[model samples]
Structures are given as structure tokens and as C-alpha cells.
Target chain A: MRITNFLFDKVGKWSKQFSNLPDRYIKRAMEQVYWRNPKGIQYKPNAVVKRKKYHFSVHRPWTGEFRQENSPGRLHPKVFVEPIKEWSFFRGDRVEILVGKDKGKQGIIKQIFQERNWVIVEGLNCKLKQIGDDKEFSGVYIQEEKPLLVTTDVKLVDPSDLTATTIEWRFTEDGDKVRVSTRTGRIIPIPASVEETIDYKTKATYLEQPKDTKADAVTEITFEPKLATFEMDIMEKMGIKDDRVPPKSFWY
Target chain B: MANLRVMCKLLKNLNISNVKAHSIPSDRRYKNWGAQEVKSGRSWKKEELRLKSNSDLHKYVLLKERNMLLTMEEEAKAQIQLFPSPERIDKVEDSMENLESVIRERNVAYHKLETGRTGERPYKMSKNAFGLRYRHEMSEYTMPKHMNKDWYEEFRSYKHDRYTEQFLLKYREKSYVSKRRQQIRDFNHVIHLLNRFPDMDMQALKEQYPNVDIEKAKASRKYGGHFAPK
Candidate 1:
């Protein structure tokens, strides 16, 4: 127990000194150390001490073992939170402002920040920004667009009549998923790169040529046969004499 | 001769009339009657509306109004009692809006044919509080901005005061500090990555972090470790 405590203290102090080191390097070092002295050390189990009505839980009891077996270090807070899904709107989609000062105004979506559910529409919401000193530039004011518009404040515009329309997910007769305008009941074409899966049902079917028919056509064509004495005649004209020798006869 | 006369009279009495049914269409709300007395079609397209006469358009409007009233009554009944899908109200409202817009378009077209002007609201160039110019729909009874005393007073109060300016200054300073801290963190992370991966793609790293000076990061002592300088 004294030797195990001493080893734990030494490793703990060394690890504490290099706490700021990158995770991968520390993990590599720990793996090497673990393999070098596999049976020399053991991890101390977590202890729960209870008093009256209170409970105290202690983890990583000086044996230099991680709290979680597989995980090398502490888990990040972000890992516990699920990431936000992507919004429906994309850059270059025509949208109408639903509320605020620019209500009923239509513009193309210039940018989208899915993380914050914010979008920037081109030439829709504008604000005045004070630029330069009033004394130096004589009250130079530049009209700038607002940083972002909330995603909920904008609605997609139907391309048919350029009016605000709600979208509904629907399946086509060919079993392909498509977006349909709730107002007009018209199918809205899926924008490129937005939907990853290709609909094979919508693809045109080509008539395949019969394999037997192609083979029959090839067999129908006739080929002229070459004379077997043609090569010998050619060799004789070239003055190359053939020397005939029997088997098992020695010749230089 | 009497039997033939009686048969002809019976056939005449059994003759089917061509008069269409006047009953309202049955929907999912009606449990007993699933068959529709009258066939209902989709919303009127622009081309179809253009081909329709004024009287025809008016008749369509009346029919839509009746359907909308019936839907409203059904929705009210459903609201009083819990219904499985409350979205039926929204669907009814959307169809009503579409019908009304189609009617409005035909009305505008008819008015334009009679008069030399479009029967739509006119827009005027207006400026907001930020002094940004925009086209605003003109109101029927709105006074001029300069003439309205209440509006002028409100506009005067809308300007940023001294406290607002101070708050903005402090907010900008806080945002700048946060941005600077983010940059420092990114730089340190890049340095750590370089120390761990000596053969890492330099170009990709540079592209990923444009703000960090790659040369400066390479020259830093923290990235050099315990090795002597060559």
C-alpha cells in the first residue's frame, strides 16, 4: 500500500505539472506508462461516504485513474447538449418579412446562421451607422443593414405569385419526398445540395437491348478464312530456308 | 293498348332530372355521410380567374363564403370539444385567405378595365427613425410627419441620449474584450496543435485560422518544447 501510494503521488505530481499539455500527448504518455508497468499498479475505486442525512462522493482516489473508464479526461459541457438542426431557408431563397418595421417586404436570403436561428436578407432591414468623427468627416453617416433578422420573422415566398406561403412536406406519386406550398398546393422543387438522397423513382427508365439478339447479330456476320500455306509461301519468297532435323540428333 | 299506355306513363314518371345537388360536401368531420353531394375542386388558378366573368367570379365568391362559414362552425364545434387534430382550423384559414386573394385579384382586374387606374393601395417614399428611405404604403388619413405634433415629439425622444451613448460604449468595449479573448484562445489552440502534429498541413491551418500569425506562432517558445534551437 505504501509503494502504491508513493507511485500514485509521483505520477499525480508529474501529470499536474503538464496539465496544460495537449490531450493526445498526455493520453499517449499514459498509454505508454500503462503498458510498461501493467501489473505494478491498480486503480482505486470511487468511494461514497455517508453521514447522517448527507452523502459525499469522491472520484479518482489518487491512483491516477480517470473517472470514466474509456474517457481519458474530463468531458466538455457542450458534449451534454444536443446540436441545433439546420433551418429550412437557404441563401438566395426569396422570403417575405412577416413582422417588424420591414413587415410584408420581400427579399432574397443573403446569409443564414443556423446556430442562432438568424438570417440576413438582402436590402430588407437597414440601419444607419455613424462612421468617422463628426468634426473630421462632417457627420458622415452610412446606411448599413442590421446584423441579423430572426428566422421566425421571415416566411418563404411562393415563386408562382411571389406571395408568402407556408410549406408542407409531401410525397409525390413516384414516392419521392417533396415540399409543397400549402396555399397553392404546388410542388416546390428541392434546392440543390439541400437534399442528399437522389430519387431513383423519378429517374427515366431506359429500354435495354436484348443480349441474345446482339449475339445473334454478331454470329450472322461471316469471316473469310486465310490459307494455311500463305505463311510458308511468304517465307520461301524471303529466301529463308527451313532446316529439318530429327529428334535425338546432335548438331552444332 | 291500356297496358302499353300504363308502361309509357311509368317510364315518363321515372325520368331522372339533371339538376345538380345543393347539399354541402361531406368532410372528415361528418361520420355518417362520407360521400360528397357536390364535387369540390382545388383553388382557382390565375389563368382560370382571368377567363372567368364578373358574375362567375361573384358566384365563386359566394360559394367560398358559404364553405368558409361552414368550416368555421365545424372548427368552433371542435374547439368546444377536444379534437384530435386542431390544425384543421389553420388549413381552413389558409384556404379562405387564398380564395379571398383570388377574388381580390379579379376585382382589381375588373376595376382596372372600367377605370384607367389599378384599384390597389398606393405607396409613397418614406423615411424611418434611422433616416433610411423606404417605400411605404400610403394611408388614407395619415397627416404629414412635420404637421403631426405627437409624432414630432415621439421622434425627438427617439434620439440616443447621454446614458445610451455611455451604455453603447461600454457594450462595445466588452464585446471587443470577448473577441480578443477568443482570438487568444484560437492562437493557443493552433500552437498546441502544431506542437502535437509536426507534419500537419500548414496551408489548411492557415486557411482555418486567418487571424493567427503562423510565423509568429512558429517562433513562439511554447511550441519549441525542451529542444535546443538549430
Candidate 2:
């Protein structure tokens, strides 16, 4: 497989779920193809030379910062990201800090970088930095919350008791998967806000754009199975008669 | 200047809006030309397209949208400005793909029910001049293979030759070297991963690099950390 396909796999499902963009769009926006095989037969057919590795930091792959970080010929060290079996953390998830000054303090998950198993809590694990500091003036300080590893730096909070607890994925009698708090054995429901994206809060609330097909129109089924191929059906509907047979031809 | 102004007046009165530019009738421009982003819904799902009739599929006016997007993208490139919501192109393309697939499915279903064969284009796995196997998509010709001198001239069926024999030897050697290098690289990468993340998920590592022997990688000299043993 190509490195582009490999990098595409690195992008976590839950991490990009909030974008609400199609997978194809994300792949198109993020990939930097330096060279590709032109339209002709060659020794190496369909060969492409593109950036092999990327520095996946706090910056999203589709952002300007990510492009800058992964600028041509500027290679970063290999990142050893632990492979996760299943992603449980999501946007709007309440989690407690485990290894910082804000330890035991709970905050909602504001952003996630599943590439590195990192998540940014709403207002926790912050570090102050001074920007544009010069001799003539003391620069203003800004607090930025850094990402924390979901494995060691944070734990999900059980909504039932409002305390940090380990959770296990369990299926109910109805066959719906739910995250159950192991400490209290109570079902911590996934929030409705999980479906929130940059475009719209929910699918129902999405405002229809000018080019968008109406919901009712899309749902209306007009298909009736016919004993003809697509082209045949279309020609019949258009009232085009073709009785002349094609000339004899051979296939090698 | 006065003559130019008069010409402009005449042109305005003539109503040149109907004039086609490069075969495109509409003024090729995006609706949200100056906006920060162009918001749109996701691509039409295959399930949704399957419900549409043949005429509805034929009436799908996606070509104009594609043309407009290409024009806007070119303009943005020329001006060095960010093309807002580039994803619209991808969405359109994805929807087009879904539409075509849905149409193909219907056609295939009809053909299979009638002819007891997949109505797809016929192809066969055949060797090329270089002795490499590729799917040869069969095409219609006016005459049989033996009689079609033009086809034979163009294709030149594979034949054993001294030059080709030597070429194949070197090509196979090159391929083998690259394949070996790739295996070594994968092994080294796995070792480095283990060194950095000792407690990493083994299943994931195995899944990612299925070719690398996990036990062999662990037993390598470079596997452990460079720390003093307690």
C-alpha cells in the first residue's frame, strides 16, 4: 500500500467524526502529492512520490499549521502511537485529569488528536506562554491547554456519581452498545452532542443550502424494477427506437 | 475614448448575455464567491440514489457544478487565494460515483436475471511483452486476431527473445532487492516502535506490520531500552 493510504489509516474515526466531512474530502485536503506518474505506460506504472511521514501534533491534518509542520523536506522524528482497539472517548465527554496540577478536576473533551491518543480537556492542563515579547515591551501572556494522553493522563468520569471511573463497553439486551462504568456498574449514556460537527450541531438542524436537494424529494422513491438495463430503460422512456443490429465484431 | 464608450453602449444594448463562452453558456462562477466557506450537505448516498428513477439519474445536472468548481479553483490558484470549501468538489465527485454505481448495479441486476452472465466488460488476465501479467480488457475489432494485421502491428504479441530474457533477469533481481529492503525496513521500524513504546498494543503492531515476526523482533539486540538493569 502507498504511504498516503497508511497515513489515511492513522487518522482516527472518532477524531474526524466531528468534522462531518466526507472521507474522500479529508483525504483530498490533507494529502500533499509532490509527483505522480503521468498518463502513459512506464517501467513503474502508477508510481507516486509523496511525503512518507508527517508530524501529527495537536494540529489537525487539514489545518495550515499541520501543513507548515509537515512542510516539504522538513521531516520529524517517528511518533510511536499506541494502537487503540476501540475509541471510547468522544467530543463533549467529561473526563478527569490524572497527572497534572488540575488532577482530579473534571472537564469536557474540547478536542481530540486520535493519531497520538491525545485529547484536549476544556480548561485543564494549561501552560502560559508569552508572545511578541520585545525589549521595549513586555508581551501579553496567553494560557493554552495542552493535549493529554487518554491512556495515562485522564480517565472518563462516571455521570452517575460524578467521579472518575474505568469504563467497559457492554451490549444491552436490546443489542445497543453502551459504555458502562465499571466502578458503579451504571450505564453512562453517550451524549447527543457527540454528533455535533463544525458545520451543524445535528443532522436535523442542518440548514439546507441552495444546491441541496430537499429532504422529502430525496426520500421519495421513484424506482420501479424493469426488465431492461439502465440505457435500455432510458431509451425506451425517451421513445427512441433502435432496430438496427450492430455489425459483427471480434474480441481478442 | 469616446468611440470605446459608444462601442460599450452598443454592446450593452445588444445584450451579449446570451453569448456562449468556450461552450459554457452560464457565467462560470461560484454562488459564494467571496465567502469564507461554502456550506453544503454530504454526498448523496448510494441507497438514496438507488431510489431515483433512470430519468431522474439522467437529469442530474452535476457537470455544470463541476465546471463551475474547476473554474473557481483555477481562479483561486491564479490569485493565490484560499479556495473556500474545496470539499464541495469531492462531495460532487463522490455523489457522481455513487450515482454511476447505482446505475451499474441496476443494469447488472437486469443483465444477470436475463442472460445468466455479468454484463460487465469482458477482460482476461494475460501476459504483456515484458512477461508481466495484467488484466487485458478485451475490445471489439473488425476481424479475427489472425486476420487483423493492424491490431497485430499495434499490440505485437509476446515472443521469446534474447534481449527480453536478459531484461527479465535484471527486472526480477531489482524487484527482489526492493522487496528484501522493504522487509528489513519494516523489521527495523517494528523494533524501534517496541523500544519507544514497550507497553504498546502488540495486536495493533502485528496488524500494522503483518510481515514482521513479532517474536523475532522482540528477541533482536535493539529491542530493549539502554537503561541499567536493576
lDDT of 1: 0.46
Off by over 4 Å in 2: A2-9, B1-31
lDDT of 2 by residue, A63-167 (tens): 889889888889777676766667789889999999979998999998988888999999899999899899999999999999999978999999988999988
Q: What is the C-alpha lDDT profile of model 2 across B1-230, one tens digit per residue?
A: 22121111101111112334356435543456678887776777788778878877776466556777888899999988878988888887887888899998998898899998888888998767876667788998888899988887877767869877898899999989978887888888889888877777788788778888999999999889688879
- The DockQ-derived docking category for candidate 1 is incorrect
Q: Could you tell me which residue pairs clash in candidate 1?
A: none
Residue clash pairs of candidate 2: none
Per-model root-mean-square deviation over C-alphas: 39.5, 8.8
TM-score per model over all chains: 0.26, 0.88
Worst 10 residues of 1 chain B by lDDT: B6-15
Interface RMSD of 2: 15.0
